[model samples]
Target: MKKRQRKVRLIRAAIQLVFFIVAPALFSTAFAGVKSIFQAIAAGQPVTWNSFLDVTGALLLITVLFGRHFCGYACAFGSLGDAMYELTLFIRQKVFHKKGRHGYPEKVVRCLQKVKYILLAFILLSIFTGWYANLQGMSPWDVFSMLTARKLPNASYKIGIILLVLILIGMCTQERFFCQFLCPMGAVFALMPILPSALFKRDRSKCPAKCGLCKKRCPAHLDIDGDTPLSGECICCHACEATCPRKNIQIGQEVEELKEEAAVSKTPVKREKSAAVSK
Candidate 1:
């Protein structure tokens, strides 16, 4: 617990320094975004809507640099999902004495997991149409502001109840029911088209018995060993690498030695076949 707390504190300090102190833009990056929107409105010109570009750029910057560390380290929803996972583990171990029946086939689970990406598209469409304009009452940001300011016509008891219920359901589900099954942000990060991006790739040859322990640890339900997993389903949680006893996994650095060894192995086999043919 101390180690976890220490690591979290160090990471928090880094975030405070980089985001709050040195570059607030590093965190929000919402400066130019809000500016452009308001500027366009002031000029009475058509505003380029959809700041997904900014969000995508930020995601890529973080992903290429840190290998999905944003999800593991910074994202609020991801952090909440991880907390829920811990809660679920506790409930199963202490309260119930066993896990929920590992329901459904692996293939079915993987298939159903694709729903998140589709839902992400729906969110984008809804945003454009202002489908959630009514949700201002339910917004957490609004609630906090209202509470702090101590003035509101409707404080939204219903919204508070709804949020709590959702959070509870998310906590109790089999696996990140909210993050894995619902979060559009998560879906986007997982499905980021460009992949590998000069990051640390798995050394398939280094595994004893070529055991796929890394794949087993993946909460995003990715085959970290079988494929270069840059899918929309992958959260880059690093649970797989963390579970590796051999420390064979890496994040943003490639295993060039392994690549060279693989190349040498292939060359020797080809050379042996050539020599046999000559003989």
Candidate 2:
């Protein structure tokens, strides 16, 4: 199980690294496309297709089918947050000889998560009201994108640089701080209608009493046990599946099929034993 967990983490990390280097601007591009659509509407202009729209549309289609795998394994900003959090843990354990907490308190984190939705609404409002043009150099994602592309941000991007630094600081203190509580793009992903086939399902009957490993391991702090269908906040990271001691968690269809197969397998064995006893 430990080996399996390590393998999973390694595979995700490799994919993240590749995407971070190869297509770091994907989120920014897709978001720009969304803004453009509304900006055109506000201007009473016809919305036309473009490369940005193509990117956004493709990502939305993928999200509807596969949950937020892009956030978990492909988003450069999310990968950066994961790196910062891991670096913080390394510093605490190796340098200060102190263990890091898993995350912030669940209640506080849940409340903070709501802020992203508000941020998303404000952004859309700014775009529609034509105020977004005035705020051109204020986006931290723009700064991050510039840095990743090996280009220096101009003097106009000073505020953006500052905001990026602050977000990185937040990432060091909490895992996925920007992703869970601040990213407008993350808010959009969380609201997407993901298919059940892509969701991780837990068998409560198989879970030991009082066991909360899955919830504890979740970066989003989702209430997997209490939430019947699980929250859309799930990024499809599979941390819960990897951490379960009893291996009781599986994809929705997988859990059902496994149980059916187990029942069928036991029936044949039971029938053979009864025949031997009667003979």
Candidate 3:
């Protein structure tokens, strides 16, 4: 299982590199195409609306069907964050002899989670108000474009550099920090619940008692300890499933036992007279 997980990660890394770096370099306008559509809509321009549909519509459909697998698997910016995080861990352990990894406190993380929603709201507001440029300076996609292509924005964007540095530090210290707390794009996907069932799930019946490994490995710190899978927060990263020692976790959802429990609870309990009373 470990070997299989490793192979999956390697393949994912290759795909991210090729699609993000190689594909964009080879084809002009490959990067930031989606952003352009949003900008066009915000500006009320006579834009090639079909191109927008071609890109983001597909992603939105996939998000609805499978959850945010795009973020976990295909997003170039996500891959960059993961790389920064791993490099930070390597440096910390090898140089400082740190025995364990730590993330933001649960309280802090929860508070931070709300930020993404706020950001999403703000982005929507900007779009409706035709103020898309409000986010232009520090847009992560634009920063990625500048970094990859060695092209400067038409105007100076100091905030973009500053935000990029902060993102690197955040990723290094906390797994998927930006995705969890600040990515408006990710927020859009997360708002839409996946159809039928999430693409992956945990079997609590088979899960070992007292094993919190899945929660610890989860980038979103989702509550996988429950009787049924809680997947709204899940990013489809499979980190939790991979780290499970029992290998009980699997891809695809199972009908929750909770439904049966609910049904049983709804039936009234029968009361029988005591035999002593009858005698």
Pick by lDDT: which candidate is best? Answer: 2
TM-score of 1: 0.62
Q: Worst ten-residue run, lDDT, model 2?
A: 223-232
TM-score of each: 0.62, 0.90, 0.77
RMSD of each: 8.0, 3.0, 8.4
Number of clashing residue pairs in every model?
3, 0, 0
lDDT, candidates in the order shown: 0.55, 0.84, 0.69
| lDDT of candidate 3 over 109-131, digit per residue (tens) | 87888898898777777776877
- Report the lDDT tens digits of candidate 1 across residue range 129-151: 55644544654323423443455
- After superposition on all CA atoms, how large is the RMSD of candidate 1? 8.0
Evaluated against the true structure, the overall lDDT of model 2 is: 0.84
